[model samples]
Target: MESSAAKYCCDNINNHGSSSQSQTSTCMQKFRLYETRSNFYMIGRDKSRTYWRVLKIDRLDPSELNIREDSTTYTESECSELLRRIHEGNISTGGLRFVTICYGIVGFIKFLGPYYMLLITKRRQIGSIRGHNVYAVSKTEMIPVPNATVNSSIADSKDENRYKKLLCTVDLTKDFFFSYSYHVMLSLQKNLCNNEPGQFLYETMFVWNEFLTRGIRGHLQNTLWTVALVYGFFKQATLSVSGRDFKLTLIARRSRHYAGTR
Candidate 1:
């Protein structure tokens, strides 16, 4: 059943009012990670930081990604109070501690050991189109889901380290770019002409993190907590034609479907 808020949003859109625009406009862009002994709590906030939500990731399982999003929306004060209570309750067990701040989740990958969550820890604004900011990965982090004691033998294996090293060899900061509010994977024409929802677009070939985000997206039924990253090339430059200067931009999107095929 659609909640009153969702129904109101649809009604507002049907009337063509300015009350609600693209869903991307409301997607969470900033996140803070907190960790206890058995779980990782990720707090996400919107652009204004007015709306808040929490996602809980279980740390007890080394082989599976168990993610659950809290259904309640929270205000700044209420969220602080909730976190305070959580800390108080877990004080005897080395209470919740700040892990790291991240722009968005890259995805999760598993090796011979436990699953590692890839995160875009740092980003740089490379360019923009139609007022939407596009960012390139400046730095990334891969954190093991389970503690070291859980998978001691597998985590320290030579194959696991080799696989992890191979994954890190592909430099993400070079050509990859993503937008928080724009469908950077699709062309401008498709973006303007098509009215498809953001969640559907995420399943398309251009999004490199499609496979990685599938579990979380399926669990939450929304793409609000993840950013769709386009793996390809983006370049912007200035051109001079006869005495006039114009901005030129180029974007090349790699097709995941035909990537490894002959």
Candidate 2:
């Protein structure tokens, strides 16, 4: 009997026209049919009626069911039109995509902001101390004794000593200058750090520092110190992942230290 009543309700719904009123009428008819068939079974009658009510509510046009608008003011056509507009992208463009891009850029800059300030502070501090050899005593202490004699047969070791001297004496200012690359790289790294993104920082820093101490010394020459500074900056930035490829090119231009040497 329950199956027959349910089938009867479904048939009426299908046969009726698609108008909202027709849908409502079909629902009412189904409810009445179920009640009559299950008159003796109160529980079954109650369950069927409740099910029919839910089906009726579900059949109603969703557009006409605005919670924000007053129930008394809602109309089927108006609700349908609203839903259509939303589907067609007639709403504002201020969505998560735009907001996310904006926030990501801002957050990236914010993360690198302090490092930039520190760079400026360092530059100014060095500038203020210019012409004063603060490490003069240390330099004097490390210098080889002028009168010390070594075995002439060990001439091969002289090349190694020369290389070390070059590494220590290369003037960094001649080859490099302060720029935004480091800041950007640091920012990128910080952004990655927040999300725990990559291992580039550790790996690249080790390689870059080794390159600076040895590989870059011969070509850097008078600008050796500048190259070291720039290389350090690049290493930091690359570690952060904010460093771009083009800036590395700019830094490479001053790498004359690698010129005549292998």
Candidate 3:
């Protein structure tokens, strides 16, 4: 894809004919440092860092560059404001104009392609909710009831009240389970994609998933007795850090317990 700067330049070149020279020069000045060697040692006054040694920069294709150094500078406030505007649902090009200008200016001094520059430029604007507001539900009005005023008619309707309460609790529990389960699945999928399968983090995730799934299933069934059962299983699974074998065993146990209950 053409870099955002390149696209911007193409669009503005005709409208600002005389101004294209400075803009193009600025674009050319940004050079991305494409380093091939991944391993490098940095020695500092108090600390040193080691990176894995890999390919040589000389072996890399001339067109491939990794790091870009741009001279564009913006105050944190300005960046925050741009992000705020974005968060407030203004996603149009005009809404992003300030951010684009900020990056384009910076790109002149830095060595980055327009694409990468745009990516970095918009990093601050991705997840901010600066101009958003949240309103909470208001409390319901309370009706005064005398402590001694128990009508026989209402008392006779206790079974209906109990049934209604049970139905509401069950619905609430189901809603909670669905929401929590979706998040758990998302988290597990993210971890699996980002990390090695046999790693400690991965194994722990398996254990967590097993424990959580059992608990959620138990809750869905309204098996009140299984609450402590799942909790204890999760506590044990998390506390034991021997390795994958132990974690697998815990997961198996949780699965078996869930199956038996069903």
Worst 10 residues of 1 by lDDT: 12-21
User: Mind giving the per-residue lDDT tens digits that candidate 1 earns over 1-262?
Assistant: 2223322422322333121234334778899998877678888898898988777777777788877666666799977876776676566667778999999888778878788988889999888888788999999999998866566688879899999999999888877889988899898999888788767998889998898888777766678777788888898888999999987889988877776533
Error of 2 at 131 (Å): 29
Select the stronger candidate by lDDT from 2 and 3.
2
Instruction: Give per-residue CA lDDT, model 3, range 1-262, as digits (tens).
Output: 2234433422322232122122212111111121112200100110011111111011112222222111222244543442343323323322222211111011111111111111111111111112221111111111111111222344326664564345335221111111101112124346346532211221232232233224222222221111111111211122346553332211112232343442
Give lDDT tens digits, candidate 2, residues 36-143.
111110010121233222111111111121001011112344433422432233123211111000000000001111100001112211111112111000110121
Backbone clashes in model 1: 0
Sorting all predicted structures by lDDT, with the top scorer first, yields 1, 2, 3
Clashes of each: 0, 14, 12
The TM-score of predicted model 1 comes to 0.85
Compared with the true structure, model 2 gives a TM-score of 0.20
Model 1 residue 215 CA deviation in Å: 2.0
Error of 1 at 4 (Å): 32
